[model samples]
Target: MQLGGDETRRLADFLAASGSGSVPSDTGGYIVMPTKGSPADVIRALQDLTATDRMDALAMLLREASEKPAILGDLVSRLAADERFIEKAAAAMNLAVYRQVLFRLETMIDDPTVKEGQFQALLEEQPWLFGSEYSCILDRRRWTRDEITDFVPRRTTDGRVELIEIKTPLHGKSLFNWDASHKVWAPGVELSRVVAQAENYLEKLDRNRDGILANDREDVTKMRARIIIGRDRDDDQRDALRRHNGHLHRIEIITFDGLLAIAKRVLRYFEDAPAEQCVVLGT
Candidate 1:
């Protein structure tokens, strides 16, 4: 096989001054090379192009892209051959999309007006913002006769529906109270009310679970729930929330801040992922 490439102006100048045909000890602005190069070498060959060569490369590449669009279908076929391949590809795509999401999330974290309704709307549009624990948002939002949950995202494990009840993050109000006497944390009235509200929603879902399954094919097994309210303002508050949540059995609580942190972790996972695992298509 033969390798082909275009050179960058800087690299071309270096090569000219160096008077070397072979790129010393590394990759080059592609002027083409012998075949049997590593995968990275091949990719660099395609990417490292002079301004003059870029237009021609772009046209040829566009033609190649347009000519064999079935290459993506070929990738899907390859994924079907290996489940691990599919998972890696999916993860790569999700991480690529998360950059846009993180921007909005970071912006909202400090914005006062991005409240419950705003958060709900964002989550509705981008449910993956909730992380991979939840499979997908259920089509059936009305869990019971009078109960309408913010979201009924199904758990990834068994497809059982998990209720997500999000209230406005603590702004001027308090969600936790510091108990000076006992040296412990206590739930503020708002937090207590939000927890109870989530419990009620769970209870209603449990009572109406069979009916819901029959009607909508949605599973609400045992009715576990997540209450997303308040903010972990500082290390103490964050630790306090963690301790408070540890005692609970069925319902789990996370502040908006915690939720954002989860997304950042996900972003970092992709950043650190192996290059081989990151590629879903192309040689």
Candidate 2:
């Protein structure tokens, strides 16, 4: 299908998320075209498109994007996550104008792909990544409101409180080249999955705060929600966090890079913490 500007952006986003997996043959499936240019080049070309313009420019952009295979997956993912794409989708009308775009954009909204056990798996892999000194006590079987309180949260050194929830990122419906070699990752899913999981966990926490919080004045420490993605994310995720500063519930999104950073920091912090502050497995 010939994609309009918005559709083009959506396609780009999907392609970015495909991450070395195979690109789907059908439009309904995820499509990540290869790209060789710098991300800046891709975005610039996208920003300049109009309804009247032929898709020649868009095609060239995609063709060029296929070159830098290493970064293309991540670059396209970031492009799709760009706020401008969201705004454009809100303004779009024609499906041809943005059907592909709308579908990709909608993927971020209520990602149901997050399986029940996935959260628990993420937590098991990286306990300290969420700033949770205690190991996770997840009840993966149910999304019960009552289950929220059974899990214990940790307090940060800065005196903020946070509830750590780990997550896994879902890719577009297709496989990328990396999938052929078994190296799989998707940047858009990397960001959206974390953001979505954090939001869900926060809602639960807020709903059951009375059960979890001892008292209001006790200070809600950091109230954290961490997401552990299988892939890398981009600056757009950081931008999302920056825009939602005050309302962020002290939640933090951690990519593989963030994981490494935390590993180093946690070691130092643990050294200063009192022996009693150490996490006891069941607590």
Candidate 3:
């Protein structure tokens, strides 16, 4: 069946809304065209629609295709045939997945008893949250035969090699405690301890830099360290982090909430553009 003007418009609205992480009111109302014969036939038709670059039609197609596993498989196969369509579809899918992850992270960050391993898992799964320009090269990666750091990392694009240490959000009080007597914020005990740990990791890497590069095939001479822990207590805490981070030339510290914010920003980058259409149209 050919998509009518109203259907096309609705699909556009849906695509726009989904890109922004909002569910359109009429998502469930869109109709999926029935397959003519085999799943391949349906995909061929969808490929035709994607040529138009109408993101709405593609959104509708994906929604409908999701209900038919066989057809979905066909759709996946066809993704390779069109670079533009595949890129758009991939971005849309990534944004959706990361948004769900962000929601779960919000809950996890609030739980004071959450373990450092859990946070490490999240970062490993979604490396973009760490930084737009960072990717996970190693997790619980061994520096020596017996010495493992929480993460051995790489630049997402191109930059200095880095080391990362994560601590449980529950391990710290506020990242910074209000020192009312001096009317200034000071790094909390947990934050200080983690920072020290990161520093130690950096030193270890430096001492074994040549060995690590030979083993991992990654340069570590300019490696820096980052410690992720706790949550910001207030604006004062954030200001404290800025001041504290400024002095530390080699190691940077960030709170759990700060990490979450970075993740959300990454999601926004993908959602800013309307995805290209991928709906299959009639014969």
Candidate lDDT scores, in order, read: 0.69, 0.45, 0.69
Candidates arranged by lDDT, highest first = 3, 1, 2
Sequence-dependent TM-score of model 2: 0.32
Candidate 1 Cα outliers beyond 4 Å, as residue runs: 1-97, 216-221, 274-283
Clashes of each: 3, 27, 5
TM-score of 3: 0.64
Residue by residue across 1-283, what tens digits does model 3's lDDT show? 8999998997897688679865555646543332445657656755755544345536655776877766876675565455355456555555666678889888888877777789888877767677567644654476655456777777767755677788877544677788889998888778888787777766777788788788877666677887778777677878888999999978888788788888788667656745532112110
lDDT value, residue 79 of candidate 1: 35
Worst ten in a row by lDDT for model 2? 86-95
Per-residue lDDT value at 176 in model 1: 79
RMSD of each: 13.2, 24.7, 12.3
lDDT, candidate 1, 71-135, per-residue tens = 64555455335534434544455555567878897788678788788888888887767876776
